[model samples]
Target chain A: MEEGCSCIYSRMASRFSIGLLMILAIVLLMVRVLYVIYRCGKPLPKGVSQSFTTLIVLGSGGHTAEMLSLLSVLRKDRFTPRFYIAAATDNMSLQKARSFEDSVAEKPAVKEASQFMQIYRSREVGQSYVTSVWTTIVAIVHALWLMIRIRPQVILCNGPGTCIPLCVIAFVFKVLGIRWSSIFYVESVARVKKLSLSGLLLYKLRIADQFFVQWPQLHKKYPRAHYVGCLMIEF
Target chain B: MEDRENAKRVVFVTVGTTSFDALVKAVVSEDVKDELQKRGFTHLLIQMGRGIFFPTKCDGADGSLVVDYFTFSSSIADYIRSASLVISHAGSGSIFETLKLGKPLIVVVNEDLMDNHQCELAEALEERKHLYYTRPHTLYQTLKKMELESLVRYTPGDGTPVARIIDRFLGFPDD
Candidate 1:
């Protein structure tokens, strides 16, 4: 009877150890996620004269227009070798970006440092849920390939479904200590009262290093988002 | 009186990317045309976008007003720049472009649009006295009451703050 009781006790003890290990694993993961969120944006150890490689994402129509307008203000000298990525279906945005780069090139000391790339759209409007699942996976894989190839130090994107996959991969890279690709998301001026889907995900997940909203009302609702006023203005 | 009659005050009506049949239909009605003519607008240029409703009335057949339209344009900037007044659907692009050009603007909120964010922008801008907002049914009334001189000039937003944030994020010492 003593031997049987001891056997039961051993079984229970092993089960308890397994449960403890799972709890510990979950806690560690939570800590790591928090660490990556708050630990970032703390000034990196870098020289004052250092330049950064930036990836600028161009969404459709208004989003693209706003991003280009915002880009007008950023110092080209500081964000060198810029990568402008647009959805493969959107030819006009890339054309617009190229012209913008051409205009910037007119200013002396600005070299031809801009590169244009197209990635698969994560979801097309009115696509079926089943098909979208497959397409989303394809898009994510494409995004992962681009992330690995570019290994950008900074990513600037407004509200675009495509940005979600890229940002997720970037966050994973941060978690793995592969690279710290800081994400900066600017909510479109069109979004006055609420955040766009991509903006909400980035904001809630703590993936975006910096979030900006054009309207004051949005900033009030989402306290974390910086109220930067209307960004779609003449330079 | 002669100079006012001869002045080419163009009122550009744009649906912008998405279709708003109601806006197109309402603007072309007799009452709205009479209102524009009364307001001393010499031309009515409509960018109908993807709307199925083709405006057929007052296509310069009447010498009092000149009306022209196209489904789309390569760029609407030139049109907006030449226009003295703009009546636009509540698309942020159209609203900002018209405002940036310092043109008197009336934004018609499309009630059919699933997203209400567009309406929010229109309301906010209207509240600031930057522009006027109305529904298609009440556009004629809004146009009648629109005082262009009362509209406040929209000062373009500065990008310095965003630049500073980016700089700070990258660890570039504040200058």
Candidate 2:
């Protein structure tokens, strides 16, 4: 009878210890998340120089145009070895990107600095919701693979649905201490009053390191977003 | 054919990548054509994207107005650059491209599109006197009332400020 009572007590003690460990782990994770969020938008402790590989996500039409405009003004010499990712379904965006690269890349170094990659869109416009679930999984897997391969130091994206997966993977990498790819999201000039779905997700979740909006109204709406004025025009 | 030496006053109308049938229809109507001729626009070029409606009264129409249109162009920059006036759908891409070129622009907002954020951009630019915005039904009136001389030239926004912020975030010292 004593042996049976001791066994019950030991089992209960082990279970209680396990539960306590889980709670402790949860608290640690919460603290870590809070710390990471606090560090967002601040300069990195160890800043990288030269050989900075940047990953640029290009959406179709307007998004691509806006992103290209932003890149036109960015110091290309500083951000070298760019990897441009576009949706497989979007044929024009990467072509435009390549042309833009060619236009800006006068030297051999800048000329050889760009590579284009295509990923499947999570959900194409007008696609049924039922089939999109499978595609979204496929897209997430592809995004993970690309993220691991590129391991970019900096990521730049505007309002594009394809960017959501890549940004999320980068955030996970940040949380895991694998890579700290600073994500910079510029809300499209078209979105004045409301954030796009991708922008809202990254903003609410604090995935993007720095969020920029073209209009002052968006800056007012999303206090965290930097009001950088319209990005479409090149000075 | 009338005067080779005189610069042809071209008015470019772009619907961008999406099909804006209402915009295409409104721009090509007889009233709009008459207004174009009255305004001394020698040529009218329409970029009708995937729209089923094609203006039947194009090319060599009895009057001095020469109307031509294509479904798509590899690059519309050249067209926008050469145009004296630009009539465009309220797509932000189209709006900025025209404004950047310093062309007198009239933005036609397609009300049919759901979740249309195009109006916000169009209205904002219109408020700034960078361009004019109107619905398809009122495009003719907007065109008639447009004061190209009064329209302010758009001063291109400098990306230096944004780049500086990015540099700071990347821990690069400002030069």
Question: What would the TM-scores of all predictions be?
Answer: 0.90, 0.95
Candidate 1, residue B71: lDDT: 89
DockQ per model, Cα: 0.56, 0.67
RMSD of 2: 1.8
Worst 10 residues of 2 chain A by lDDT: A43-52
Residue-level lDDT tens digits of model 1 in B1-175: 4664578899999998879999999998889999999988888999999999998745454566778889899789899999999999988888898999999999999999786678888898899999999999999999888898999999988888998988887777778
After superposition, candidate 2 runs with Cα above 4 Å error: A46-48, B4-7
Q: Proportion of native contacts in model 1?
A: 0.66
- CA lDDT scores, all candidates in order: 0.87, 0.88
Worst 10 residues of 2 chain B by lDDT: B56-65
Grade the docking of candidate 1. Answer: medium
Candidate 2 local lDDT, B67-87, one digit each (tens): 788999988989999899999
